[model samples]
Target: MAGAAPILETRDLTIRFGGHVAVDGVSCAFERGTLTAIVGPNGAGKTTYFNLISGQLRASAGAVLLKGAPITRLAAPARARLGLGRAFQLTNLFPNLNVLENVRLAVQARAGTGLDFLSMAARRRDLAARAEACLARVRLAERAHASAAALSHGDQRKLEVAILLALEPDIFMFDEPTAGMSVDEVPVILDLIEAIKREGDKTVLLVEHKMDVVRRLADRVIVLHNGALVADGEPAAVVASPIVQEAYLGIRTAP
Candidate 1:
């Protein structure tokens, strides 16, 4: 996994809705086995860019490449089949499903089968093991049997991470992983992200607002303003850049 080729790349990517350009001329490369943070103020096109990359929305211009092959033309499920996994800003989970079943479903998706149909999922040793392990990684093992809707908000977020981890994707894209969480809950989510990169060698692309979280987790940071990259570099350097402060922080700070 460490020696894998470039997992994802966007070249001059732009997305337009009618006459409005949501993402304009955004080009960036995300390498395999590295954690990257995409940071920006609201309306800076962060979600729009992620939508284009994940194939939920089409790019008005430019191409999205996976492992050096163009995938902009591919659909979301097609991209998922090619080892691309995404977690939305809002928790998207089966509210009625228990944590284990939810994660098992993701594992089954990666395995190209549906355990609930032809197979008894509980008896599938490999899938159960993987799902449980994923839960443990997110600190949700204790609540593996709890209904997703019954869990606390933070636990639901952890469940979201577990579901994605169960997919075992080469490239993991997370949109606002820490949104609407308590101050203490933020680190819990951050710890799960760190565990993914450290233990799974997963390539992570995160869009986050918490400057502290970005500085701690990101190996490289990309800052966007007005739908284009304003700064991209080491966390400290990018945060210190005047363009980033002006667009993102509203006030310039001395470097």
Candidate 2:
């Protein structure tokens, strides 16, 4: 009788560091099957807001809700267990492990299979199959045996996405998914993200600075400035708003 609750919601979420408020009382709701881009200039708290929601930083005030349930107090791993997945701006990886091993670990974690090296051997075939499938999706299957640390920046980014895929989260949070990638390597990641949006069952939140990428992928856009939400609307409207144009896009109208 009632409509389904939003996949994620932040209610006046605030976080202060020392004397400054980094993310100031921002409230927004994200629905299923929509991609919302969070855009702002450097130091606008976009990533900090993401850290709070993903449980990397504690919120000084307010709450984070997943499917209408409060998860503000949960730690990062706990939140991940609750279906909140985050791919960082930096490539977070097991540098010592080979690419396949890194992804297999995520698969094992998601399947509730503890990381017992000896026991893992018994389940290697199945877990590796699943992990390889994820890698294939991101075009990293050929690098399965290579050390994750040795991959190029672009490949590392792809491996991180593969790991995220292995976890099968309901909400995908990507922080600048294409930060330092090459011109040639950028499209693979973008195509993967586009495919995710096309799935139409997952909720996606992206913090990106590239206006073109935002325009192409975002269903909605919300702007943040000085840790506070400044503008929110359809992508074109939000990007063209005077406040966003001045604060984020660095565009100033002539008098």
- The candidate scoring highest on lDDT is 2
TM-score of each: 0.92, 0.96
What does candidate 2's lDDT look like per residue over 188-238, in tens digits?
888999998999999899999899999999999999999999999999999
Q: Which candidate is the best by TM-score?
A: 2
**Model 2 residue 4 lDDT score:** 92
Model 2 error, position 94 (Å): 0.5
Instruction: Report the alpha-carbon TM-score of model 2 versus the true structure.
Output: 0.96
What lDDT is reached at residue 64 by model 2? 97
Task: Flag regions of model 1 displaced more than 4 Å.
Answer: 1-5, 252-255
Residue-level error in angstroms, candidate 2, position 123: 4.0
Supply candidate 1's per-residue lDDT for 146.
Answer: 88
Kindly list the per-residue Cα lDDT of model 1 for residues 135-195, writing each as its tens digit.
9888889998989999998888888888888888888888988888778878778887887
What's the distance in Å from true for residue 57, model 2? Answer: 0.7
